[model samples]
Target: MRLSLKVWRQSNKEAAGGFEDYKLDNVSPDMSFLEMFDVLNEQLIEEGKEPVAFDHDCREGICGMCSMYINGRPHGPLRGVTTCQLHMRSFKDGDTIVVEPWRAQAFPVIKDLVVDRDAFDRVISAGGFISVNTGNAQDANSLPVPKEAADDAFAAAACIGCGACVAACKNASAMLFVSAKISQLALLPQGQAERSIRAEKMVAQMDAEGFGACTNTGACSAECPKEISLENIARMNREYIGAKFSSSAV
Candidate 1:
């Protein structure tokens, strides 16, 4: 259960960074990837060395904060699994693992294995919402949307903005994330009011954030934890084109 870890070490965004090797002994195959990191950090602290800096808000994988590039794959080698949920058993004994942060210009390195993802916040702030003045509460079944649309909306809404989409893309595109958000609204009755405007504003903001364009590589959906489909990207394109042609967001 022992292995060598080659982890990225960077003091700050401007600082030069490189991989530092460490030997992890007495490791348990049952341990989660983040738990293995905790063991490593404890050992480093005992030796009066600064522990590797990584993000993990909820180690249970619900918060999407446990973002990392494990052995060149976002959230480790497993499909549809976040780093916090990745189990050490996935790797063989005596394996050499390379860990790093999400590599993208928009997602700058905040420290070792931690990148600033506030660009996602900026995109969300750019009209990823509805504006109708519906005075709050309504009947439970008042506006029954079609079941298929509801399912599609729910599927698209599952995106957690982990940026695995960007990390997996050759050009580091955020289209999957953006398109997921756009499709979530475009497929639902509640989101209809702001659909067109939302698509336009979010797309503009995504470009402003310096994210690369989608080239149909399909890597983003493959790496996505929620398995956000590429169909959402197509839906977003349709929404954006339709919005540009319309005078109003109707």
Candidate 2:
């Protein structure tokens, strides 16, 4: 396949950025999107041009680092798949693909298609973990949890924090991502000790990071590669309200 790519390029965060067009030929439909990029980079290197810089690690889709907006969709036109999993066959020959980074105030462009996602890390650090010791792995397992709760927690835990939710939202909201982290622990017995504080802190940090408010447009869940449910957001709102009430009563 022969294709034209319009890729966003920036030397650094403060630098002006724009699209640079390139023509890629002899492409294989079987090659993964990142693999095609590798080919493009090789071609650029041969011509002594600066290869595009994009974030990618463990191209198996496990890391969620291969973030890109292909055409107009996050992670390309596919549903429930990351850019690393996207293949050339998704597009036809002679296609003009536009690639850009996540557009949000909190996610400043680093270089090329890569954006600084440290805001997410800060939100996680605010309270995304279980600090309460459950004694040991065996002891933690002894706590009985309902089948439904376990399943829900597992689903919420599948969130890879790729920021697709923010990129997809018109307001650049991160409620879905924050809620998924909250629900993952809120549904489990092990996460009970700090449940109230966890919800409050994570949400507070998300707000502090300059992420926009959710308007229930469902764009976040729709664009999420993990397919994280919108129900998690509702649950988080409940958790936050409950935390506020509990704190007020004390």
C-alpha lDDT score of every prediction, in listed order: 0.90, 0.94
lDDT of 1 at 204: 94
What is the per-residue lDDT of model 1 for residues 113-218, given as tens digits with 9 covering 90 to 100? 9999999989989978776665877776998898999999999999988899999999988999999988888887878877777889999999999999999989
Candidate 2 overall Cα lDDT vs. reference?
0.94
Compared with the true structure, model 2 gives a TM-score of 0.97
lDDT tens per residue, model 2, 138-212:
655579999999999999999999999999999999999999999999999879888999988999999999999
TM-score of 1: 0.97
Q: All predictions: root-mean-square deviation over Cα?
A: 1.5, 1.4
